[model samples]
Target: MWDLLDPYSYEFFVKGVVAATLAGALCGLVGVFIVLRGMSYIGHGLSHAIFGGFAACSVVGANYYVGAGAWGLGSALAINAISRSRRIGADAAIGVVTTASFALGVAMISIWGSRGASFDAALFGSILGISPTDLWVLTGVTVFTVGVVVLRYRALLFTTFDPEVAGASGVKVARTDALLMLVLSLSILTTLNVIGVTLVAATLVIPAVVARMLTNSFAHMLVLSTAIGATCGFVGMNLSYHLDVPSGTTIVLTGAAVFLLVLAGTGGRRLSRTARSAPAPVRPEETVSLP
Candidate 1:
């Protein structure tokens, strides 16, 4: 078994391991907010927007991460601005931004001539192709994300749970939301190299969603989500190597399996609780105040 794994062992494999773990951990950390604030679609939009950056960088022979990060940040800012409008709606805003950004990226690629390889690996992650430079960039993103989330945890939490109250308490809810969105954008950018724009949401949403099913506290949910994400990355990479499959798809499948298992474990119990609670809610006055 060890010798079989030896063929998979190399500098590239090491880089892949490091990149995936860091990306997973960072996504899990930021995903807590994504889940709480209903910003999962924001991850989706930002991922596509970052892909635009990647395309432009590829055309100009620049570093892809830098380009992707820039576009991701831009996407975050766009989402923040649009979502502030009461008319657009958050989900609608994300859809508009993602579609426009993606179209722009595709147009850029078309104008530069169809060099498919750069975008191909980006669309479907190639863990085996992750370079040392990419690993370093990913590590830096991880550190930055961790630091920001830690520093602003309380404020972010307050905003997520009760933005009106947080604003009344003098917390700048709009600013914090924008900042968090920016962090989420970077995270989405980082994971894009591993899972592509289309599938990055799986990494951001699956582990966090599963973690939520397992735990109620935000901190515990963060920890659990990170573990699940890293495990999915590792397992999916290995499975892809062994089975000659796409790493991104395998990783997503692994996450989905975990999500299903968590659902199976707790789904019935939660439903039972909901069913049982109905009887207690029959008292009109009590029911009115209960909510």
Candidate 2:
């Protein structure tokens, strides 16, 4: 309806819509792998870790994306490396590293009194606050993520389902994990502007989980999750402007609503198995059980 489209008469709304859509889609795409690998905590933790960088950069007058991106990447790698020790589990590593980073941010905020960027905005979100630079950064990250998935589909898929098998088949699990963490770090950096650090994990998680309930095929899930996320972003942005709600809150609520609808429609019966147990060659040289 024209009522819905009227907001675009303002250029800010237009940019908000685009940014939200791309941010949501990127989170959904990466979330599929994160969910399959049981790395849901990583999403939550990395967002918190990025917050530390956000606060530090804001205080120092540095480029937020660059500094925050590096900090997040380091946190992710540290978690991955610590988990690999077999001494500490991934969950513990996430809890320790990210929480420490988050604590650092809190300390900085208390000390600096929220200097450069709006502390409230970083914690929450403001779609109207989006700039041309933010949009371009978001677009670039989305393109890069898509490229990584497309070009390295087999390895990523394998890594998600069965890293042990993947490693046995010369898949280089460590490198794949590092690359994924890199993508995730950048995505989180871009996503923070649209949805805020608080809600990034939900944006990353909800769409992928919803898609999983709809289908067992990994490829189908990817497509469906991306579509769902984009839909939520578009619809939520419009609703937020009309309702005067925070754009990030509205977007996540929209995804949650979609989740409930799918949950009810599916009757919660699709609680099926993952591809970890069964061994099937999806293609020659790829011994992944593509669920």
Please name the candidate that would achieve the greatest lDDT relative to the true structure. Answer: 2
Q: Show pairs that collide, candidate 1.
A: none
Taking the tens digit of each residue's C-alpha lDDT, what string does model 2 give over 155-201? 88877766777888888999999999999999888978788889889
Tell me the RMSD of model 1 versus the true structure.
5.8
lDDT of 1 by residue, 1-291 (tens): 795577455777767766777777777778767776666777777788777787778777776666667777877888877766787577877787788878888888888854433576688888765877777877887888888877887777677666776788788988998888778877777776677778888788888888777765567877888888888888877777777776788888988998778779888464232111111212211212111
Model 1 residue runs over 4 Å out of place are: 114-117, 268-291
49: Cα error in model 2, Å: 0.6
Q: How many clashes in each structure?
A: 0, 0
Clashing pairs in 2: none
